[model samples]
Target: MTDDQYVAFGLSPTSGKPEMLNSDIVVAYYDKDDGSFHAVDYSVTARSQCDGTYGMCPDERVNGRNDASVIGGERRNGVTSITFSRPYETNDQLDMPISRYSDPITVIAAIGHLNTRKEANYHDDFVTKSNVVLDFTSSEGNSCSTLVGGGQETPRYLPWPANIIPRGTTNFTATIGPTGGERGYSALTRLADSPSWGLAWWINDLLIPEIYVERGQTYYFTVYGGNDHLNSARYHPLYITSSPEGGFRQKTVDEQNREQVFAGVSYSKMGMPEPTAVGDMCEWRHTAMDAWEDSLTFEEYKDTLYKKCDGDLAGSLVWTVETETPDLVYYQCYSHRNFGWKIHVVDSGRKERQEGNNRGSTLLPTPLLASLLLATTRLLR
Candidate 1:
């Protein structure tokens, strides 16, 4: 693995443990000199430490005896593909047994480079956002799925490029009601009935739409969860996270302890000069509903009422995407689970080119417009 790129898969013997330390994992890489794939067994005994600090350190390892065999692999077009197999029951303490009749297993996958000395380096955010569960005994065959949070139904819309929001100081009229298309706050009611019910977000007119944004652009989310609107919005404070399905509350204890905070280009960095009344942004109205009008611009709200704002009735969040921002992020309710959707960050140059090409036409293409309209009508009903 000298100076070669590699992919590692960490398997948790338990259902929800995805951490590498004290767990069984397999690392695979392509050997360019031999023109073959290689797999190594590894188990991290302790997290790396530096300068008396205990966390966020480099890769440290206590190698395990090799037990995996590579079936085949190849490198083509800058992509490395590999296939490997291991015993379902390796009696070695470092090897976690895979039972075909057992429950689903959690898997964490990551990619990173190796130094000149062939030592694996740290993966700087080049990892899966959430642990994926794999079912071995499913009648439907080997299948993988994300563990949906809050027991809420899966989001209906798939992430589509045509639904992208271009760069600029775009304003979003944010509200909290039912997950889009529902008649009431069913999730909240379900949660009241059972603690497992999750929350959801409704942005503008869409229910938890997977939004695509451009780096170096600004977004102004004008939230409205006052007395005039649904009470659910009052308790749902929106925040951005690098983890999907709202990393606020995860299934595993280790994951729950991990910091899911994404502090880049946030309200705190924007010189709020005061703590938010609730969580990240200023409340829409601290007292009377009529105190703040919908006609007020983001700048106006920021300059006057933002600093003194307090309470959870409603609020606004401003994000200025930086170039180094992760390609994928999520806008989630701070206090609940799975209440938001994915935000895909794209290069500003690419978005600018798309916008320029569309400048000739003020309207969307007929087919796209019709599809959007139909979706809106269905959601409204």
Candidate 2:
């Protein structure tokens, strides 16, 4: 799954060109004996360029490498997909460095590949089977009715593995939590959780309108997330997020303009989902939807969008402003892993914006401004 905030594009900062790196894995498990859900496996391709096809570590020195994997999947529409982590299913593993580019790229795909071939190799080749259990709480817990050891209780699926347990008899039902998957939604969740639906990247964690970075300057941005206190939180659900703090906050996307509120990290906790084990992946894919190609400059893209959507300074929607409004002044289209353009705003010394008019003035008067001016003239008369 691609991270919503950063678009993944294969770019080699080292090579300074588009890259078609190979890195992907796909694994599946089938019943060999009773065929009662035996083998469980997730794929892995060492070459996977998750943060947009590229090497996480260009070499060994920059061992800023990370390890990731994916697991737990059932065939649906003939396609297999699931979240990353253990207990439920695992994705492939990616342990790459962060120095490949001056900017760090996080591969936000299916992850946490436990119980794959690695885990299965725990016992001996003659392993009978102690992997799964009926108890949603205790995966290998005793069966409810039979009180037997093998409680091969099938759990429900999820976009990501949700803490759930199984319950009841004969019916084979499971829930999402508390009772340990009593509703048996795992299969559905697993079915629904796909590469397309794969949101391995923390949507809210990714910074919005990813800072149209400054090139050659060498950038460093950290993404932080957590819950109230982070008890079991390696990183909690609602800490300082990497993405835009929702509400009436700054944004680059059109859909976000409707926000009635703005940046308030406190409220984000109560209103948002608790952070899960699955981490955020920040990928960058170069895009030129609003321009000719990667060659398009940030100023050009902004000028173009201003021209296409709001027109030039002549139109009410468009304004050649003295200052930049991150939200109102969009300068990008489509998306790259985490950026659309790199810009450096250089304030010229000679340019003194016309102060005779309100600073908000563009090329035309706003209808509201025009109305106010006319009313003032009549009152003076």
Candidate 3:
């Protein structure tokens, strides 16, 4: 099953246009015995003129070059999923260089099938030419201002108002410190929400603020609490849960119970002494932990974004929010309660109109500004 299955990304939505000079296509094959897939190779193509079909001829400059590599893959329930990685800048003239700090990039996607000879066939109807663009480096949602040009400038964080919800990839820096005389998980990068002022001072280390995140977006929480003095993180490891009052050591019956309360995606460390390993000292025992383990394959577990470190100086927890995420969840300590805050999950596209209404007169609206910037950037390229 290693033939005729592929995904293509073109710089231009139109496949047979002159702008399709450096489009990238990844070809994959499947293994029936192991129920796994592999991205075998990639091709850089070009089309100097329209060919009346949605196909571009391979560019001769890099005809035999292969830069794509398979990370992991699996096929189950008739659905095949493959995870692959490629460099943002491959330095190949026939390939498009993805900028780390540039504006959103517009591209086309297509899929192909197998032929009678077990070779890749033409894609009849499996193509997507939507207007939506993707920003791979967007770590602070749509509100964060990205640096243009090609300098190594960090993205400027914009205050997220209460009324305006967040969308796209969001980042949060987590720190452990004394809040109201009690040690709690605080978001150092997120500004505290103030109803009267619309936004409060930065470094919300004292507020223990509730986090609002949108569905269908990726979130990265850089946890510095583990590196705090006296290794406070060893006892206050943060976790997301459905229960407002954490049930880490709660009893269900008066006689005997070892049930721990945990919900959603929990945390795990990167290397040895894995938190999920059975019989390990740092093992996480909970109902949700069992569910999380059962839901993932070995490959999926290896590539999971959920991460945590108990006594390490620094760590991170990443969660790609899905529709199944509960509307209300709490971020509480694994060993203790009330050390974290609420996490509100909102649906996508619900905040577009609200964000438009909240824009200032001096600044252009997000949609308009994005379009203008994208067009300008493309012309300059």
Candidate 4:
């Protein structure tokens, strides 16, 4: 039974430098007792120089101090397919920081089993050839634009989590959101002030292209998601209630507090998935209900909001922008009212205005300039 189980190299950041200083190395396996797959980081090293012989030193253990997390994965075909993610930067001296270099980096991997004494042995053919050079780049099948949560002067950055699937597939999955760590995708401050925020599914943490819309054209994107920050603590599946004159108010479902009040404040009715329990994660996709409706559960709403797939907290969605024409085009979660991203749409008349400007420029008489240039050349001859 153990021979059928594979120790596969779980998913890593799909787009990035393989530089030891900028990326992470993940190894994953399955556990029969739990009936689930688990993963551990194999990237931390105490030695400044590695001899390329894995498992020979104390620093080579999988669960060292790299602080990596297994977002989510499944056991299929006797192989435990898992996805591993870490930050591109860190302050730890022993941990290797993922560098942002764009050049090619060499990668050497090996497969072996460890004994009860915690020692591993590799046969002669367990290593890669010296001629192999791995190229690390951003996700190719999808477009991505890196974004910060928000800031005042020097904006803070969130590490775009790596995904384990290609774009356009319904099965494309990822687990990226705010977490507690030095490089976690947390915002420095609330992004309520920016009239226009840069947000999108960064293809490989490399690019964020601008999306232009026309005034009267209707437009739509694939998905919108994020976590809620309450008193600096992160919560998922948060709901916000909106009123025409009263603005927005945050709400969540609680069993004990369903009809209870706290400190003279009453909780508004819960939204989708009526009877939502405390700490239950939720998210919203485009649905029949108006964007700011109060009811969390809808008969026709898309409830695929949180950063978890199949009960594991790591997922991503492909966000594609499509517009027919709009007065409003933005991406904001109900939980985060004062923050979200805005689309850049220009007036259709601007194209005609540019044409008129070009016509006016031709009035300068190019023939006269050409004649003057000819005379100057003749004089020189």
* Highest TM-score against the true fold, candidate: 1
- Alpha-carbon deviation at 277 in model 4, angstroms: 62
**Cα lDDT of model 1 by residue, 339-377, tens digit:** 566676776444223443112113244566678779999
As for model 3, its CA RMSD to the true structure in angstroms is 26.4
TM-scores for every predicted model: 0.33, 0.18, 0.30, 0.27
**Candidate 1 stretches greater than 4 Å from native:** 1-3, 49-64, 139-381
Q: Residue 192 of candidate 1: its Cα lDDT?
A: 24
Relative to the unseen true structure, what is the C-alpha lDDT of residue 379 in candidate 1, on a scale of 0 to 100?
100
Candidate 4 residue-wise lDDT at 35: 64
Where does candidate 2 stray beyond 4 Å? 1-24, 27-53, 56-206, 209-364, 372-381
List lDDT for all candidates, in order: 0.49, 0.22, 0.42, 0.30
For candidate 2, write residues 182-296 as lDDT tens digits: 1111111222221111111222121121122111222222222222131221111212122222211213335343432211122354563221221222222124332312212
Candidate 3 clash pair list: 2-29, 4-120, 247-261
Model 4 lDDT tens row, 88-129: 565644355555575544554444332222222211113333
Model 4 / residue 219 / CA error / Å: 85
For TM-score, candidate 3 versus 4, the one ahead is 3
lDDT of 3 by residue, 41-97 (tens): 334232211111112323332244556678987654444566777678877654667
Please state the error at residue 58 of candidate 1 in Å.
Answer: 16
Between 2 and 3, whose lDDT is larger? 3
Against the hidden true structure, what lDDT does model 2 obtain?
0.22
CA shift at 199, candidate 1, in angstroms? 37
